[model samples]
Target: NQTKMFDEKKLDINDEKYSSFGAVLTDDNNFYFTSARNTARKTYGANEQPYLDMYMATYNADGSFSEPTPISDINTKWHDGPAAVTADGNTMYFSGESFKESKQFERDKDNNLKLGQIYLFKATKTDGKWGNIQPLPLNDKTYSTGNPAISADGKTLYFVSNRPGGQGGNDIWKVEVKGNNTYGEPQNLGDKVNTPGNDNFPYLTTEGKLYFSSDGRKGFGALDIFVIDLAKGTEAKNVGLPVNSGQDDFAFSFNDSKEIGFFSSNRTGVDQLYSATPICGVEAIVMVRDANTGKPLASAKVAILDERNNVIETRTADTNGKVTYSVDCDRAYTIQASMSGYENNSFPIAKTHGGEVNVMADLRPIVEIVKEIEVVLNDIFFEFDKSNITKEAAFELDKLVEAMNNNPEMVIMVKAHTDNRGSAQYNMNLSNKRAKATVQYVISKGIA
Candidate 1:
């Protein structure tokens, strides 16, 4: 659908005051966005400047929005606004300035309030109202973690964080939702998606593509919405034109079907919402299989290489021995597929008109005819002092597994060895553990 272009238009929902750039369309047909219009302060003082707050407006059937209503329950007097809601509409995750009521604002030497780093917060809908606000486990007081974007199934949450150990200023991070509010450690999105500049407002589409605005990557404006196909593992590319402009453009969100979407932009000098439509793209499907037997190779490691032969992305073939990635037209690519006991294979894909591109990678089996005391197999390597089977070791073990599968009557012994660095007993024990782990890994791969 990359051939179509979008005609962008600013929504009538703009005001002279500051308006935050995030907006999400919920399943219940209500539009939710961030705005600083509701900053009336009572806790601090009457003259204190009001901060951003989450506002909801009803989406009428005639394409106009009703009067906006600020949700005071979730909004604090400090900073709170736009949020991402789950498909079931039961939970909401949003960004807000860190606060604990007592220590809400920390002032500087001049007694001026120092803005707190934004943190992610969660709230659940009960009886048609959102309450039970809880901070995410990954939220740090020293760093900021806001701009929440939840996956469709609600298992992963992606957000922008200025946390330590980032590629640059405010890199994007994702954490696994381990059910019942527990979360795993946050993982940086890496240098591919992150840049030396600020990258915020991550929006994950239903199709596994991440769309976020970044001033770091090449773009037409200050902050352009660039989409990276998570499944394809390609570099992010700007969405271009009407959706992007010379001003800051970000906070992109799409509907369930992806037919139409909304994004916030400051092209009009004031932050306002705009709608976008998908224009061009193609689904590139790659299939891996055995060259001789024509059997689909499941679990095959597929690496997508660009013109410079740099592996931009890697994917594991599914049970059907197939993986699909979205790509633009007029770009060439190569795919390398490798499995245990097979010669690595590469399939070259040439650029063409926009559409689906099917690639077949046929890997040849590496047969080692042995006449020695034991049928020799390839070597298995492990990390330093670790007994876990690495991906490389697994590939070697696959060769052994395939040999055993081919000759059902053959049984081989595992001769474990260790160097002289460790204590004799300790080294022996570690080597034995490694041997046992290798056997278990083979069994786990269905090689009895």
Candidate 2:
């Protein structure tokens, strides 16, 4: 049930008359969402085309909601919906769009009024009333920006934008929330999270996980919800299956304390809300380092191999010599670390019941040279009459394997000698077997 935690049912709160999406909740069970159904507004003078607006409702204990009403004080003639409130319940950030009053609501080429690009606005709650609405300083009148999500501490704000300097039609961006109602410059989320298509509706959880929607990345629909571990710097992963379908799926909001969340999708041909529960999984972190010097090996290739030695995923170690992968629980995995001048090392991760697993892949440096023999392996002593490899023999042979990898074209011949304590015929046969086994071990390491 990794991505199928919910049955994908449209919320009963949705009205057949209009599109509903972008739902967030307060601790008191009050729901705030976006809807285009409430088109009636006293501010519109004439010929006001219907647009989305923010609505509020009280969620009843019987799984029903009170009659939803638009938050009239915040609605505009143009689109105004989708909002995120701070944990303190004192501040709110929401989407807003309208024809600029500075431009006198001028019309564009299509006889449509020039759009005042969508941007996020903030409002403060004072004496149980929300007012003092103001646009964020980063908003630009030319390019659109919306879909605000604030961190639990209110120190960071994440949103979507179609502004210049983005990798796609719409990309997610974030800015540090400077205290005293100011913000730092906005930063694009980069190519890993942004594509040439739309990416929007970024939601940051208290645990530092980023959940967003993307039409650009590979997904199950036009826009599917995806998540990434901001702390680990992993790639965006689709929250597939029941939560996603062959339609647009976006606007994911979750409350960690309540353990339930809602996301919007158009699977039934109309945008509606769906409840979802978070799924549990395991994360594997592989740290690669030098065995001798104990220094972090940056840019080392780390491959995650399954039980059958099949390569599942490969990643390069960051500057900290660490790479992480989201893996299933109760399954064995192997991590193979390889660097240019180091002997390849493999570490096995045993099956776990489900939790974080840390692996250390310490690689031994390939000894440059010993004598003129071209290959200087460790002293691999064999038993009195045994030809099979032992633990010590295998450990020593790894050096030979390392040497062969360092000099790919170089070749060495295995010559085995037995002590005079054995018969000449028996010694001859024993020597031949030892030589064959030594060659087999070398070949197993992908060397001649």
Candidate 3:
């Protein structure tokens, strides 16, 4: 059935003792996930729970996963799981509990572990073999950073951290890669993407859509995955169940199509894997223009809304003076076009098909003239004191020709005038000559 895409499947390796959390897909069709499986056997294992370790499992094209293998180089005795892989599969970013010897003194005011830190590692292909891992430079002593979502260009990084001076809890932060291997200081994404409640596990799509899990708002339970349109403001919306059952559905990753993604969830009794399929449809196109002059306006802004006045898209007209957009069909779209120097134009358009449809709208400029003033210059003039008609005079005469061509019935009086530096009679003779020269230029340019 089509609904098979939303079906949840229990991962085979999970036993009663271990917990599985964040998971990601590698380029070679192998899956990488964080697990606390075998690490529970070590002495001083803290609470005897599994310390997170990185594991890889081969995935068949038809959607079956083989047995997982532990990645030895980066995993350690302390907790190290919750991982994100870059698109090229050459780099990884993940969170880990610190293995510092002075761990007892690393507790915060609430007596929680303060030594956890995020680490960046690079993997290079050498002589047909994957090379050893190298750590990134930004690891600091104070704040713990993890859960990275690298932008499609691999230039910007988004991660989660509970460092001091945040709104509260673990806030989402980002850092832009300044150079080939250097990154700038991390900055909080602010109240839009962060909350007083814990916000973590950021997954960005190739199209710049951000998906993350949070328990901040009312949800199924624990951490529920929410989708936020990064282009529009940072408003978040719960993805809803059965994808987000009353359990933690965090650490999500998606393929390029965005139609499918994998998330670790405890909804089915254990923190296993679940897949999701997105509902698909074509979007409608809306175009706005200036109705009076038929001229496209660059500064015109458009707001498309539904019957409930909910904004579907808010876009500004391009330099061609048109705003092109797509929305689902059969919905009532309230379109409002406004510019600072023009009156606002508001109307409603009902889309029927999911194809190209043009909406012609024109806005009038603010200046009002009681009577139309027409200035017709039929003659050309010399520049400064020369008697020859310059190119500027020819340009003005071309406009007169254009007006006559556009309005066949319009008649204009061609008045030729000249400065009185010469005798009045001489000036009149010069003006007549300039007027004849202007008409000859227009005719030569094929302006009827």
Q: Which scores better on lDDT, 1 or 3?
A: 1
- Local accuracy of candidate 2 as per-residue lDDT tens digits, 380-407: 7788898988755775676677677777
Comparing candidate 1 with candidate 3, which one achieves the higher TM-score?
1
Clashing residue pairs in all predictions, respectively, total 7, 0, 7
Q: If both were scored by lDDT, which would come out higher, candidate 2 or candidate 3? A: 2
Candidate 1, poorest ten consecutive residues by summed lDDT = 41-50
Rank the models by TM-score, top first. 2, 1, 3
Ranking by lDDT: 2, 1, 3
Error of 3 at 216 (Å): 1.7
Residue pairs in candidate 3 whose N, alpha carbon or C atoms collide under 3 angstroms: 284-326, 284-327, 289-361, 290-362, 291-361, 291-362, 297-321
Top model number, lDDT: 2
What are the Cα lDDT values of the candidates?
Answer: 0.79, 0.81, 0.67
Q: Evaluate model 2: give its TM-score.
A: 0.64
Question: Any idea what lDDT model 1 has?
Answer: 0.79
Q: Summing lDDT over every window of 10 consecutive residues in candidate 2, give the lowest-scoring window.
A: 41-50
Write candidate 3's Cα lDDT for 121-172 as tens digits.
5455455344455545555556666777888787888888888868788888
TM-scores of the candidates in the order shown: 0.61, 0.64, 0.59
Question: Over the stretch 1-448, how does candidate 1's per-residue lDDT look in tens digits?
Answer: 2333456767777665566569888767778898766545433344343567888887666667898888877887667867999988889998888774336445576876665678788999999799999887777667788999999899999999888889889899899999878999889999889999999899997878898989998778699888888988977878778788899999998875535688998887767888775555666788889888889999999988777667778999999899787766678888878787676656888986555688988877756533355655556677767788886577567667776776667777786777778899998888998999988987897777
**Which portions of model 3 show Cα errors greater than 4 Å?**
1-17, 43-47, 100-135, 179-181, 282-448
Model 3 weakest 10-residue run by lDDT: 1-10
